[model samples]
Target: MNGMTDAIALALAAVLMAGAPLVLATLGETLTEKAGIINLSLDGSILLAAMAAFAVSATFDSPWLGVAAGMAVGAAMAGALGVIGIYLGQSQLAVGFILTLLARDLAYFLGHGFSRQPGPDLGVWTIPGLGEVALIGPVFGPIFGSRSPVVHLSLAAIFLCWWWMYRTEGGIRLRAVGESPRAAFGRGIRVRLVRLCYCLAGGALVGMAGAAYSLAVKPGWGRPQGCEGAGWIVLAIVIFGGWHPVRAALGAFFFAALQVSGIYLQDIFPSIPAPVFQVAPFPMMILTLLAANLGRAGRVQDMIRRHPFLKRLSQGWSIDPPAALGQDFDPRKGL
Candidate 1:
């Protein structure tokens, strides 16, 4: 029984670990989307930032410095995206997609030997006196005591994003660009400058997302490393969140918890193939797609669709995902 409790605790820790990366990335991307731009380059930004962070941390022997360096690289990458998507008039979708490929190749080329490499771990902090009280320590678990710093940072990211989106004047301006760039411009807002700033800021968060993985999560770098996992999931999470920062964090937790549960399933049933738990998640996500889109027309049978209720629910009312996802902003086109 004691062992079982420990295992459950570990599972909880894993959920926190896995969820932090996505929460950070999705929060950054959420801002980008709220500004009416899509950032498919997330995969690339993460990879590049991770590699940069790993290399810097390994060289300097300080994980914190490494993370800052990585954020710089990630921000530069975002600046490039801004140049193309915001200034050069390129399609954000196409540009971001191409950058994804570029980022993958770059990360592989640089991080091949660095894959799974070890680095200094980020420090964890906890409330004083909580350890003496037996109840709180195990209850909060490593959440505040012995876990990675990224977890707290992720939580902070949520509130910071909220502040930036609604509370501050700059935050309000960023949303303005998103809501209607042309209108914002008419009102004297620098459309290009605002988008550019958001892109760089968003990229920095994605970079921090990468740093979270390398320093806090993996504590190293390597081939087949997972900048891809959390970054790729950001798109889904933002949609699941309806483009809200708080909702995005919840979606991140849900996805991460499910992933941790997959491991828990294996520990409980060792006789079962571990690979089943590994591949099962994709199938489950697919099922969720069907369930979430319960009334949407079947892809091949859309023309022959006849379900009145599903059609109505699918039209625009139910839990439909974000509609503006991936669409680019155009001053020429009105929202």
Candidate 2:
């Protein structure tokens, strides 16, 4: 019993650490989407940022500098998306797809020299008193108390984003722009500027996530960077989470749990091919996404409406995308 408890605790800790990058990336995309922009270059952006972060850190021997470099790269990529897609009225999907391919190749070519290289490590920091508490500390301490600053940042971002979106004036305006740019413009909001700002901010967060991968989570730079498909996963998680910061974060952790389980399952069933375990999570997450959306079915809606308790539960589970997502807004045209 004690051994099982210990194993579970360790697993939880691993999940938190492993999920931090995903959490940041998901939140970033959620913010961008909430502003009516879709930065689909996440996969490539993360890869490029990871390479830049690792290269910079290895060169300067400073993780902080590496993080900054990663953010710059991410913002640059996002800014391009905003300028071309949002301002110039190009197809967001096409521009983003091209940028992703460009960034991926850039990362591979530029980062080739730095592959498998050592970089400055961002070590862990344990809170002073949390682990010393009497009854619960023994269990919760390792799970939450001791962790890298990146993990703490990821945790803090969840609540901070939730508060910004639900409890602040700016958040209200941002949501308004996403729902209807014309409506937001009539109400005196700077629709284009707001969208652009949020897009850059979101991109910065995504870049930081890339830094977290090379500096903390995976701890090296290499081809097949082990995070190849992470950006797409982050994008899906944002949709699965209904564009809510907290729920999106939960989705990240859930995916992380799936990854950790894959490792354990490999040991339990050695006959199964390793690639099968690795690819399983993607399909499983897609299924979960389908299940989550079932609440939108007419019959499900009717059943929930018939019961007050179920209706209330359904309200929390329902998915709602911003009405103007992926559309361009032109201030000159009064739209």
Estimate candidate 1's alpha-carbon lDDT, on a 0 to 1 scale.
0.77
lDDT tens digits, residue span 1-335, model 1: 86877767777778878889889888888888777678888988898888888888887898889889878977888788888988787888888889888987998798777666667767675667655677776656545567678888888889999987889999878777777666777888887788788788888989998888888877778876755655677777777666778877887888888887888789899999998987776566546645555434467237325666656644433444334434455566543
**Highest TM-score among the candidates is held by which one?**
2
In model 1, how large is the Cα lDDT of residue 156?
88
Model 2 residue 317 CA deviation in Å: 1.9
Give candidate 2's error at residue 295 in angstroms.
1.9
Give me the runs in candidate 2 sitting further than 4 Å from their true place: none
**Number of clashing residue pairs, candidate 1:** 6
Residues forming the 10-long window of minimal summed lDDT in candidate 2: 311-320
TM-score attained by model 1:
0.84
As a whole number from 0 to 100, the lDDT of residue 11 in candidate 2 is: 95
- Candidate 2, residue 228: Cα displacement in angstroms equals 0.5
- For each candidate in turn, the TM-score is 0.84, 0.97
What value does the lDDT take at residue 274 in candidate 2? 96
